[model samples]
Target: MSTMTRTPELHPAANLPTRVSLADTLSQTMTMAWRAMLKMRRNFEQFFDVTLQPLLFTAMFAVIFGGAVSGDVSSYLPILIPGLIAQTVMTACVATGVQLREDMDKGVFDRFRVLPISRIAPLAGPMVADTLRYAIAATLTFATGIAMGYRPGGGVVGLTGAIVLAVFTGWSLAWVFTWFGTVGKSAQIVQGYSLMVMFPLTFLSNAFVPASTLPDWLQTFVKLNPVSHVVSAVRSLANEGTITAEVGWSVLALAIVVAIFAPLSVRSFKRKI
Candidate 1:
């Protein structure tokens, strides 16, 4: 009668699988992207750069530099629209680092680390959501150009190609800034450094002016600059409606940047969190 009852074993620690499956990773990344979109929705001001910059810069640059650069604003539209698309999208890319650093400072990423999800979800999610911002910037810049009498010789197909390329450029280049976020001490520092990197990359390229107009030395540098390739590709698409070598070069550059910085950012983020 008096028999000793064996108590069932209890394991106090339960954990998710060490490696998340590819499907799970994709799902989690999408969920995080949705979360980022919600944040953007709540903070409507986040749209300011994507919205206002295209409008202001399109009109102002066309007016101020149009006559000087290309004889009139009308002629300048073709050149300026594509270049502005590149510059505006790059500008939006900078915010990705600043916001990531801010989120880290606020302990948001710390919470993300505690969850049983793939490490890259948080990193890639916002960048994925930011494609919308890039699209908006590209579209608005094109719209402003058309409204100001700028017509793309490439027409609808070329315009669509340009927009797609611009969005890809923003998303890919954002990896560099995302790495900055993981390593930077504060949001301001990240922003300052990001701007330092961004200004030279954008302004030093053939964005607003023809590289042929610059000094030989400057032109060489501009030719070597990857942004120049992107600008050239956008122009070729939006002006000529043709896929050129520049487009291939730009795509290669974007791929190289992501291949380099994306892993670096993820590693750095893992360490910090």
Candidate 2:
């Protein structure tokens, strides 16, 4: 009898090229994001940490500044509300990083690694969900402001633009936080590091007060801070009823942040995984 040798059939996935298209990768990424949103829907209480604290801050600041600075609730409402909205949304970005760290510590990311998904999906997904959190905080802040007699000078369209800008900024900033989540030792460490960086960025800017009121050295830094541009952008839309160069620059800066950090975060995530 003649010996017969047969070649093994190649599986389609095995025969296919290893590389994936950018569109395919992004689609996978967005699917992961949708799953994260669904998780948020199921675990609504997790959001209270973000929503309640912002509401309290809005209330407290409105009360304190209304008497001390603006001399009336209505007067301070316009100024304090936008500031609170920006701060709350910005702070909410930290949750993206911390939660990622938590998930990693819990081995959720490791499970994802074994699946046939884009490496960038996990990071992108959580970031997208966090954007929703930012939106919730922004809406609540604006509603609270309205209740306190604040009005958006730019009307519905302007106000909508301002909210969209704030949400985009928050989403863009999540990339930096993703890097932290990938590299930080623990969720607590990530939280601490993010807070240390964010507090100064938010507080030192024109979020709470005019840059001119600061000392010269501080004023320089405040003007240079990206958050200053964002705060000015939102305030102009919500309070001033005008779209200026500052608003344009703020949006540009946010896009730059997303471009720069999103890639870095992906690289870091892949390395870690």
Off by over 4 Å in 2: 9-13
Model 1 pairs in collision = none
lDDT of 2 by residue, 1-273 (tens): 999999999876575546667888899878888989888899997688567977798888888768776678887777777778778886888888998999888888887665667778788877877778888888888887887778888888878888898898889888888788888989999999999989999899888777787899999999999998888888898887789899889888888988888888888888777
TM-score against native, each model: 0.96, 0.93
Q: Tell me how candidate 2 scores on lDDT.
A: 0.83
> Model 1, stretches more than 4 Å misplaced?
1-15
Candidate 1 per-residue lDDT over residues 7-64, each given as its tens digit: 8876543545778899998998899899999999999999999999999999899999
Write down the worst ten-residue block by lDDT for model 2.
11-20
lDDT: worst 10-residue window of model 1: 9-18
lDDT, candidate 1, residue 248?
A: 97
lDDT, candidate 1, at 260: 99
